[model samples]
Target: MSGLLQGIRIVELASWTYVPSAGAALSDWGAEVVKIEDTRGGDPCRYLTIGGLDPAQSRVDANFMMELGNHGKRSIGVDIKSERGRDILRRLIERADVFLTNWLPAALERADLSVERIREFNPNVIVARGSGQGSRGPERDRGGFDAASYLARGAVAYALTPPDAEYPVTQTPAFGDLQGGITLAGGIAAALFHRATTGHAPVVDSSLLSQGVWAMAPDIAAADYYGIDRIPVGNAGTAPNPAVNRYRTRDGRWIQLVFLQADRYWKGFCERIGRPDMATDERFVPLANLVANKETATAELRHTFAERDLADWQKILADEPGVWATLASPKEVLSDPQVVANGYLMTVTDAAGREYRTAAAPVQFDETPPPPRRAPEYGEHTEDILLELGFDWDAIIAAKEAGAVL
Candidate 1:
């Protein structure tokens, strides 16, 4: 299928994951996203340090994180602080349908990239801002990363961390940023609809904090209603229902079972475990009996599971009407049969033909996977973009001498 946003134009004045990720998604869906970078070094994410080691230490050659948040977009390096560069941005904004940014409100105003100034160039353009917090608040101008704003402030880390842990669990890299960016992209899509229908261009706001709240809504609601900060989790032996927790297999791998309706699957589960007789035992016969003797039942199940490897259990539960999954590691997921079959990951080839894989946004159109595109090199298309903007070589030379373009 063709891209959903085939002809849409986005001018992105953003760096890092939050706003740039949204630009990537918009570009993925076939928008023309122009990522405006500074004349020096461009986005910092391109040279990201992973776990105190250089990106190449991860054993992947490409700048994968940058590709993750910035692929499928054109890069235009400009010194936005310069008068000539500001004029260049004005020209780009005049032809754009959306102006997207992640700068702090105060910083944007200081840089002359505020909504009011943007409207002076394209009055009908949609202005979208992705921030650490919403535009209005005591900390509006305060800086935030996904770890601080989304996980910590949003209570994600608080809710997910085990009560016995010394510190709250840290979020995986850019986990919240990518999700929030996808959501922001959806908001931009909605804004486009609103503009087309009402001729009233609206300013769209999305934040890491709000995305966290949305993700943890049910947990937040339950915590508030129950007057609790965090709900504790029980292990297999202590779980109220033996079927609702993880158990280790003989091979040291684990499987998670979540049979909420234990009554319906009790006998079938026992049969799959090669212990049909246990289904009729007084200790586990009725659902209530199983709950009363949960520890014993859990022990019995653990013993049974320990008799088999994860592969053996996989075959035993292949067609069973039960809810369970083998715990796959991050590396294992890359070769997961279902993920491969569904095109969840695609190969992205950089300019030098170096290839790496990246996941697609969850949403798809017409069952067609969005084609992956490599991120631009530093100022990859700067001169071509200038030419398209109707600037001559003399102006380019002046901008180059003045350090206006990278």
Candidate 2:
């Protein structure tokens, strides 16, 4: 079967995680994505890395950029600041179904690449823009990263660290950016579907702050009902329940135990852990009592759990009633059997012929599956694309000489 977005074309005039990630998802679903990069440095992410590297190696590799948001897409280097570059982009947009970007409103206005300009060029094109905040917000002009977005809009400051800790560390993995990307992709897809049906394009705008609001909805809703504000509970949840916290195993691996309905599972849990008396104790009988005696209950549970390793606990609780637990770690999750069984990991080759394994797209459709394609080399498709755009070889070379493309 053909992919969901088989005939759709996307022109990505974006950099970094937010907009590129959305384009990548569209590419995975089989849209033809052409990533437009500046002729000089290319995307800024190409230079981002974990450790210092040799210049030669870094330029050839560009590992960080390829890994995050360039998968399943083609790259074209063009100096969009030039008139020829602008003409090239306009030509591409004329044939594109979607134009995705993350430039701020001012930057878009400065570049003359706003949705209005895109619509003037191609009225049937869906314009998707990702921003730090809403376009009309007071802080819209302010720059934001995952950390700032999480702290400001997500209320992450309240529960991001231990209560008594002096400093709170931001979560890595660009949480807000990724969430915003996913949301933007969803909106773009919806808009594309709508356009397909109605023959009218729509603007899809998303923000890191909007994504954060969705992430913290549960806590925010709880805050409205209760007079108390939510605070960091460390490894514990905000459920006001003791059975839903982390427990230390014998080998020091932390296991998360989450039994919200303690009344249904507490007796079985205690019996399984060889603590029958605690199960019948009035102080531990009801949910309120268990929550009230959280400290004592947690200590007892910890002591009981420490008698066995994580594997042992897994075996003991394999089919037990109401006791759901699992060991947590990034490595463990990556190698998990369920993930592998579900085909949540895929392998792709980079420009240098190096094979890199990465996570696959999460969404699934019975008739349309995501395609796996390598991220393109810098300006790898420049000549071919220009030729497709009706530029002859001599014209292409002259354009290159004119610094219209790199």
Instruction: Give the alpha-carbon lDDT of every model.
Output: 0.88, 0.78
Best-fitting candidate, scored by TM-score = 1
TM-score of each: 0.94, 0.91
User: What does candidate 2 score in Cα RMSD to the true structure?
Assistant: 2.9
Cand. 2 TM to true fold: 0.91
**Between which residue pairs do clashes occur in model 2?**
none
lDDT of 2 at 222: 78
Residue-level error in angstroms, candidate 1, position 97: 1.3
Please list the residue runs of candidate 1 whose C-alpha ends up more than 4 Å from where it truly belongs after superposition.
52-54, 57-60, 235-238, 285-288
lDDT of 1 by residue, 257-352 (tens): 999998899899998889998888999978889989988998898999999999999999998898999999988989999998877777876556
